[model samples]
Target chain A: MIDIELAFENLPPWAALLTAFCVFMGAFLTLTGSVGLLRLKTFYERVHAPTLGSTLGTGFILVGSMICFSVLRGRLSVHEILIAVFLTITTPVGFMLLVRSALYRDRVEGNDNVPEGNPTPGKQSAPDAAVQQD
Target chain B: MSASFLPADWPFVVLDWSLFIAQLFLGLAMACAAYRLILGPRAQDRVLGLDTFYVNAMLLLLTYGIRVASTIYFEVALIIGLLGFTGTVALSKFLMRGEVIE
Candidate 1:
């Protein structure tokens, strides 16, 4: 219902085209990342997939939006950069913890898919039963 | 007030349509994330789901900003992204250590 136009009047044709390309590319990457996250077989794999979206996808789209707005409004529009910064900084920490937890659970139940690491002796590697679920 | 600078053809039109389509795609991504949260065999999957949800929401807001041609939307979206990031970190740390405080 809301109709927002692309104000490309002032700028040359090339800038608009570039912005469009950036937006579409960003959207495509984000879509791919989400699809990969859903389709990946294992938890670790899924954890890696969405990072594509959080990283490059967010970066591209935010850049596109910022450019479009700045060109249209005739002023700087760099606030979206803050979102980019926050996401890039925090996403890895969350992902690492999630992976660690999954690894912990697998080891507690003795799963083979979970590779053993030198975290804690005897409890570090997942037992056999955990791997069966995989 | 800014109409003097406005182009003969409304620029918001292109931006809005593209953003609407983008929002639809982002919504689908959120749904996928939600599925993982619900069907997660373990608690970690749920946390991942929640984390994905937050990111998708932030992106959606950016698209909305494009739709409205207002920088205000971007600010709110930025805040949400920050809050979501912090919340996810806290939840994930809790899962890893069983105590978020430590």
Candidate 2:
């Protein structure tokens, strides 16, 4: 087996501590989000769970990665910033589409748990609203 | 090699061990997401679980990149991130409109 300690032997204490703290915190947040996703009672509640990971959990990991590579290369390794930016911008948009889709689906099913709103643009909602949509 | 090291590197052995612990947490997080993906009661729930899975997998790969000190892994993680977003977006659009392109 490869020696983990030896491989990481030269990492500076300060960078090591910083990377470890950020990684641990990110991983902890990710795990918490996963638990929430699994244990939440409703689809809407569960939908809110993974954003914890997709946002700051991912942000922390990317920051830790940027620091690690910069320290390793002794220069700015800002490629991670691309991932962070892309993720930050895209995650919310994807989740919004997903939650809106879920809401539409729930409303179509007439699940009664949905908040008040017309299922379609200008008509009374019904269980068959899905089939009757323009 | 610009790896600045303190005079005593042995005292910080916790670094590698802590990285290993973080990896374990990420793995467990992945398992939880997979559980939801495979067993979710509704279609949207499954899609949400898939969304969680891809994001966690991307971050996990990023941690591995740090562990191995390889920029290639970071590249792969980026690709995963991009693909995950596109895929989740497409899936949600399909769920909403009954077709991705329409």
Which numbered prediction scores highest in TM-score against the true structure?
2
User: Model 1's lDDT to the true fold?
Assistant: 0.73
Q: What are the per-residue Cα lDDT tens digits for candidate 2 across B34-95?
A: 99889889888888889899889988888887777777888888899889889999999999
Over A1-134, each residue of candidate 2 has an lDDT whose tens digit, in order, gives 33556556667878888888888889889999999998999987888888899888988888888877788678998998898899889988898888878878876675856755454466544544554463
For model 2, what TM-score is found for chain B?
0.87
Error of 1 at A59 (Å): 0.9
lDDT of 1 by residue, A21-42 (tens): 6666677688888888789888
TM-score of chain A, every prediction, order shown = 0.80, 0.81
Cα error, residue B86 of model 2, in Å, equals 1.3
Residue by residue across B4-39, what tens digits does model 1's lDDT show?
776644433444456666777888888888888898
